[model samples]
Target: MSSSKAGSSLLDGSGGIQPISEPKAGPRYIYYRIYTKQGALESNNPIYSNDRFISRIVSRSVAPPHTAACLKKHIFRIEKFELSTKCTLYSSLSDQAPVEDSARLALRGISGPGVSEIDPVVLVVDVSDAKKRSKVTSVEAKDLVEWSPTRRYVYYRVYDEAGEISSKTAFDDTDSCLGRVGTLCISPPYTALSLKYCIMGAEGVSPDRVCNLFEDEGGENTMKDGDTVALLSDNYPGVSKEEPLAIVYALQKDPVNPSEQSNFTKKLIVTVYGTWGDYDHTWHTTKAGEIFHTDGILLKKPYVTDSEFACYAAINSSGKKAFIHQVYSSFG
Candidate 1:
């Protein structure tokens, strides 16, 4: 008989009572190799060992077009069954409904003497996980002071403490409230003059100097040659007066050493009149394409839990089985 047939016969009824080798005692481990979908897909998948929850494997967006990357290896030490257990894969998407069989993965532990021996696994999620991480957080809005006013806009200095921020809202006059000197509503059709004054004031640059930088003969919609553009605007209710309306600006980097800049390249400025739930606000830029945020709270709050904003979780390859956290979907 061939080696395969002979091996099968060893487990047959006629071969009963054959001598067997005992499993070695002591520590054992299972290492995993999981493969996600080809593009950047956001996923918050949990991993289990021996039917017990051990860690969560999350994929991050490293590039555009659904391309994603996840933990290379998951190492779990045996606990009850000689430091080894069968590993089954599960994703948060399964919580919604019955997951397709093809989306699931089943892996059996392979035992070895030490670090050299390991069990590898590949897991796939039922749905593509593509949620971008939120960068909004609680902020401290201090004061608002006027700077310069153009023919169609007025500039003001906004004093803000919580520098970097984010928002999902579209930039519009509605849903936003910019506190004017009269505490009047600075709503839609936001004049270029209003945007310029706020940003120039925030930059501590003289509002009158705006004319020196650029000239605009065009009406409300046309931005001056060197004038800042409004990016996003919204009104966030429940904001306390102590932390009133704020303007978050993302400035251009100093080309010499861009790496030294802060993550958001942000500057927080306050509006002159204190902003309330109805107070409107707008984020402005001297040039187009620079990022900015408004009408949102800070990323971290005193009472809110981390899970609310945390979008990605990665498992450490060490024996401790530690977890690493990353902000939003940009993979680290």
Candidate 2:
């Protein structure tokens, strides 16, 4: 008859959700509290409405925020749009499973009301009737692209996948062609290289989720870093002038302040490339300390819906998830 037990009955019967991770035992000592806001207006002081981390009150109609769309997208902020860096982080408990996340991860990157749209809209969701509130109307995440004291534009490429985009073999083999360019407009530029590969899903419903490259395409081994492939939607821009399988363009983000800069991305697409399928990508993160992701394993095309690489790490475990995407310089 404790609070967790009582709250458990109301929301999905799971009341004891822990924070992403516990504080580690080390010299870096700093204590902080987490506060959640339902209808905009966040206060600097952490607000625990019920006033307790260990409450038994169930999530009465309260819904959680989408993970990736919130914090991952705003990995960096800058003063200029075109001169900005965009990023997304994904991890899965298993290469063959869903991403892991935590309570803090759930509340990672939330901006004020109408202001949410101006944000990149990364971890997005339709959470209505969220916890004690009636009729919660839609939620989108935003990250602050603040400028550091330095004038350098912020950029991150911690999770770049290096390989064929897909291997489903559904597109007319003719469409499988792509090119690889490295080190475009950036300072201290070198060969920021990661092989790019792409393939389409099989031509049918439930076509093995697109990431099951070799198995779906009847190959003994999975496609490797240098192989070229195509997907069902690879023909939008014509066939591959570079490789065997066709390729799709990577997702693009407008300068939060386009008036300032005009940078863009060219990574190949993992989902059905190019049409309106871009919005389908979403993410989930794990509690802190859970290994962010294993190193050196790039999931070129791993049968994921919407191409949003999903990452899952256990709270406090390193290398929990196993996906990697590298960053490099490219030329037009």
Candidate 3:
């Protein structure tokens, strides 16, 4: 009957008062915060403190072995939310490109330890409606053309300063006039500069050397670096196996003296094939069926194709100077 408290007897059996030991460390976890939005993804400063926040997901994989598709499934399983066909996953609110289903989360820089609340992976589930709107806001507001995602091949030939075609079979086969440099796979939104870099890599040409790209071997149509493959294909639709895009190696030379401006007398006229709205103030809005006249005085040199616009200064019909973006107009 001298049974003091059973709990006290158990404690005393171990020692006077053995300190409670901490539990062993558990598996590290990675955390991701998800949100659902109903509009186009913003490029910057997206609202995060809103009620759109869905839930946080915990994962044991530090490197995040989950692919985007797997994460989508996990989100659906945990949240019990059904996603539409238009729904896409973005790494952040500002991500322009949707995360591919096969892309791993770790490869997209979305992995971290869940020790603290800081620096958790943020993902946006873009649930924008894909149905076309019934109402018309404005003619200019409507998107006339969209960037295509279909992959296409571009045939090209490289030429030396002497106009001799390169015999390198790095691409496909070769013909007499145009030796097949190679077939470059071009998807929409691909720039001429990017295609040029690909061609240079295949040809083993030094990047420092100036290379001129032309739609034809005659060099009548100059392909600016800022020009998209879509625009080039639209302008020159006949690019095929029989006729390859020409690439000429330009030799570095002294800049033309300002006193030598008298020799530059070529007047180039541009026609707008499609309506171009002025999003950026650098150029004026142009109508679809209007002719744009140029004074031939290139305030900015057109040869600098690496520039964002690849446009030169020209006098409009009203005698006012304007910077015409090359993408919106076709040279006549």
Candidate 4:
């Protein structure tokens, strides 16, 4: 796996959380370590299992880079002939392709009732590795019932014996690496396709609108790159009045450089939208973040804007996603 050389902070979002003191001495202790440019590349990466190397992992197609990359589905496909023994393939920790990594995987084993016959083990450096003078701690396989290694600025789920994800680790301020928003692109309008609205009181009555970005120079959607664009209302002419007002939406993408064409790593953004008005605000749509190909960049979250505005998803020239929003002049 390639190490990230770009400068970034270690999950600076949560200012209230204090820095982890050190690796506590115990059977099971959670340790936090930061990997700067110098320490990013560990001697052992792409940890293998049963002497077989972990290759390509199934990743969701995402657009532009620096958006939140969802490590959703990782299927380890190994030909029957590749396996020297009967074993399930586990994914390597980082988002990097195993074909690119030549490092040897440090193998460990845990034998118990539910453990796979050829289960894979993770390799983590002692906290002291980050702080040379600090005391080195050991995390044994028995003590660690589950270990999800955070790498490539994306956190993944811990897999159980059945190859099912036991639990998902959300992005936070305490991880080995940190992610940042990448470049922004705004050009060549794309289509919005459709919009579906669901209200609390109304069950079987959802509304759909045919909306397009029409994103030319000096367009109605006055949004810039990285700004949170909320689709506030169904202001379209033929829209029904029964639909609720003050709806908000935010679309987020994964981390990938748009300028780099060879990077097949597709970018997919989750469109999370809710109502933002008064104190009665509530979430209307949960899983609305779907990316369509129209050629553009993807929109990411944390809605860092100088003022409030509404946003919509569009596309660029390369069939990637983009974002455009309508600014509320009063906020400026």
TM-score of each: 0.15, 0.17, 0.32, 0.15
Clash tally, candidates in order: 38, 68, 1, 22
Judged by whole-model lDDT over C-alpha atoms, candidate 3 comes out at 0.45
lDDT score, residue 167, model 4? 20
- Which tens-of-lDDT digit does each residue in 1-332 have in candidate 2? 78768787565556755446755432211111111111111212212332211111111112345343333222211111111222222221011121343323333222221122111112111112122223221222222232222121111111113434422332336433222111111101010111121112112112112232221212344433223222212331122322222232323333132122222122211221121112112122222122222222333434233344432211112211123222211112
Q: Indicate which candidate wins on TM-score.
A: 3
Taking the tens digit of each residue's C-alpha lDDT, what string does model 4 give over 102-193?
A: 22222112221112212222122222223442322242334433324322111112222233222222233453121111000100010021
Model 1 lDDT on a 0 to 1 scale = 0.25
Model 4, C-alpha of 44: deviation from truth (Å): 28
Per-residue lDDT tens digits for candidate 3, residues 91-191, read: 54223345787887643223332232232334444222223212222323132323233334456666878866653543444464344322222211234
Total clashes, candidate 2? 68
**Candidate 1 off by > 4 Å:** 1-21, 24-27, 39-119, 130-332
Q: Output candidate 2 Cα RMSD.
A: 23.7
lDDT by residue (1-332, candidate 1, tens digit) is: 57766676678646345667876443233232322211111112223222111122222211112111212223221111111222223232112122233442222123321111122222332111112222232222222222232212222223223332322221335423332221111111123343434344334443323121112211123343222223222322112232233443334332222223334233223222211101111111111122222212233211111223321112111111111111221221
Q: What is candidate 1's TM-score against the reference? A: 0.15
lDDT of 2: 0.23
Best by lDDT: 3
